[model samples]
Target: MKFFAGAAVLLLLFALAPFASVPAGHRGVMTTFGNPSDQVLSEGIHFRVPLAQKLNLVNVSIQKGEGEGDAASRDLQTVHTRIALNYHVKPEGAVSVFRDLGNEPGERIIIPAVQEAVKAVTARFTAEELIAKRTDVRDQIIAQLRERLARHAIVVDEFSIVNFNFSKSFNDAIEAKTTAEQLKLKAERDLQRIEVEAKQRVAQARAEAESLAIQRQQVTPELIRLREMENQRMAIDKWDGKLPNVAGGAVPFINVK
Candidate 1:
């Protein structure tokens, strides 16, 4: 009796094994005889066949991933790109996603989509444009990734370019080009300043020459004689009613005869 009761309880528990509990934020995939079924179980308690059916939980929540890739730009420059993305599998498509890509969809689906999208987008822009138009680049990448991964039932919530790296040679070349441009601009500004200064000096010299010419024109013989006559008249007006007598010097108004 004891052996039979023990067997009966064991069998009862085994029969009740179909009563399964799917955790929150997850959906259960039912597989019959090692083959996946189209039926999906939502979170909470569920039922399944004890011996022939198994329930596998698939997380339908948002997931984050990051990857790095290398691509060539339109200018033939090698670009190293690092990307971060947020994604989630559609609840409705969880079965298909699991059936197709298995549990970890990030490695197989999201990563490849990211790499291919980055390569495709980066090839459309030059190195300088890629750096200058980072927003546009990021948008294009996200668009491409969304479109590509949507086919696999993986929705891309957000995508970002974490970093862009270039070869040391390319960076050095860019620096040199920038320095050369700055030097050229400085040289042009200096040339403009020198030209302005030269024009000012020419104007000053011309003004001085014109002034000297005016002074020369004012110093004529007639003008000199007029000035002397004015001085003599002024001296006569100031003379007193007396004459100076000198023994050796000649008299002013009377001759010695």
Candidate 2:
């Protein structure tokens, strides 16, 4: 009984030895003698010798994460940006990334590549141009990032500028200059309007003087005779039992009624 009981205990202990459980979407890289070996474990229950051999859990699932902004312009301007990263372990290149950059992909590979690319692109643009042509800057960064990180199996989904800030003095100066230019334009328009009005007034005065001179020159004997005939006909029709006499002194006001 003792022998069988001892065997049973040993067997039970052996059965519960250290083993790695690799769920779905995961792979276990088996290592022997602290070095990567030829064997790989698929998704399921896996056992490794308690000490000699070990299993490293590697996620084979498509994963995604974001990196928030950090950087400064050459002229000491703050640049805030964010990048959304989409990446799947190169079901094949997993070993390569692991061999090269260890397990943490973002910290080791993606971040450095991004930082280098962003710095390289941003250095080419001035602070003002960066704020205005932000989309352009972002595109160049994305292109460079993809090209540089392609070897590491990291794919960038999108990148954007979150915030762009400039110095207060510079901003205020730009606004002030814009306002001054607008004021100058308005003054020029007003001056033109006043000059137009003056020219129109001079034209009106000239027209009136010319009209009077023509009338004065036309006052001849024939015109005076015609005027007298019209006045006499009007007087005959409008006579209200009174006679009007015009002397050389002054013509008195007549009451037509």
Candidate 3:
């Protein structure tokens, strides 16, 4: 009876050995005799042969990592770049990544692979192009990295440049140039306003001179005689405590004192 009890206990222990739980967004790769199997285990409780088979849990959820890149400007100046990357394993390719790349390959392969791809692609573009045409450059990096790392089951999710640094002197020079251009534009506007005002003044002066010339042309002998009589009347009104002896000609004058 004791021998039968011992045999039953051994069977129970063997049955309970090496069962694994795969969490949400996780997959399991089973390796036997140091060879990864083609079959894949998904989330939830899983059982594997205790000694020969091993379960390696991989998070199949979308994940992200960040790295740095460096390059030169169009003028051959240095630039430093910070990059953020998103990644996920292909459902069908998870086991292959496990076999070729080691378990938990976050920094060991994914980060380096992304960094390499970034540098490779960024080298083709200057720092200014990387900044101005950032979207295109980022897309190129994503494409190249995805192609290269997919063989290792590290799929490129999305990648972008977080920040970049250029030479301080270059930035300052650009700002100065922009300021000078603005000043030049303002000066041109001021010159244009001055020119317009001067033209208006000249036009006004010419208009007044033309009005005086028209008055002169309309004058005849009748108008001149009438003006002379009006001037004599005004001179008589201005006389005060003064007398003038007039030689009588066509018009007779009487002296009153």
Candidate 4:
């Protein structure tokens, strides 16, 4: 009678156990006798065998991660880069994620993947190209990260390069090169302006010389004789229609030849 009563009380306790509730944005993984089952339980109240099964909740929401590391560019220049990423566990792969990475997957997996991806992509580009082709570099890194993380059932949603740092020498070289280019451009423009001004001056001198030549070509013996006759007529008109008082023969003093 004692054994029967104890067994009945145990049965009632197990039957009256509370149902497991998986929270929002989480999926439930059931483990039977310390071994996880392939079946995933959706978010809601679930029933499991008492003492034989346990329910573990895995979050599937997006998460942000940041990492920084140093690498070498293709040109052998040292580069330090900080990167950020947005990712989430694959909903269907929750079982695999739980079995493989457990909790704190970001530190265990995502950060290392980011570091590796950054190094791999940076090596393919020179320091200058890294600055110029930033979009391409980011895309390549994203691709590599996706390929690497997918095996672990981690999905990468987005990736970005937060910043890139280079050696002081490289930065100084870039600045000097930019200044030299600006100076060269200014010099070329000045030379062009000077050439244009010189040509304008030459054209003005040529025009004046041509005008003088044309005037010389128009001067002939007929024109010279016409000028002398015009001057004699002018002297006759200015006379008071009377000869000078002391003239010996009262002759007209006009050169009309």
Most TM-score-accurate candidate: 4
lDDT, residue 58, model 1: 86
lDDT of 2 by residue, 28-72 (tens): 777776787545567788767777777776666767766665566
Q: On a 0 to 100 scale, what is the lDDT of residue 23 in model 4? A: 88
lDDT of 1 by residue, 129-202 (tens): 99999999999998888888889888989888999999999999989999999999999999999999999999
Clashes of each: 0, 0, 0, 0
Candidate 3 segments whose C-alpha is farther than 4 A from its true place: 1-18, 195-257
Instruction: Give the alpha carbon lDDT tens digit for every residue of 31-60 in model 4.
Output: 988899998788899988877888998888
Residue-level lDDT for 54 in candidate 1: 85
Q: Give the higher-TM-score candidate: 1 or 4.
A: 4
Q: What is the TM-score of each candidate against the true structure?
A: 0.73, 0.63, 0.73, 0.78
Worst 10-residue stretch by lDDT in candidate 2? 88-97
Error of 3 at 164 (Å): 1.2
Residue 84 in candidate 3, Cα distance off native in Å: 0.8
- lDDT of model 4, residue 75: 98
Candidate 1 minimal-lDDT segment of 10 residues = 247-256
> Candidate 4 — worst ten consecutive residues by lDDT sum?
243-252
TM-score of 3: 0.73
Model 4: residues >4 Å from true position, as ranges? 1-17, 224-257
lDDT of each candidate versus the true structure: 0.89, 0.74, 0.79, 0.90
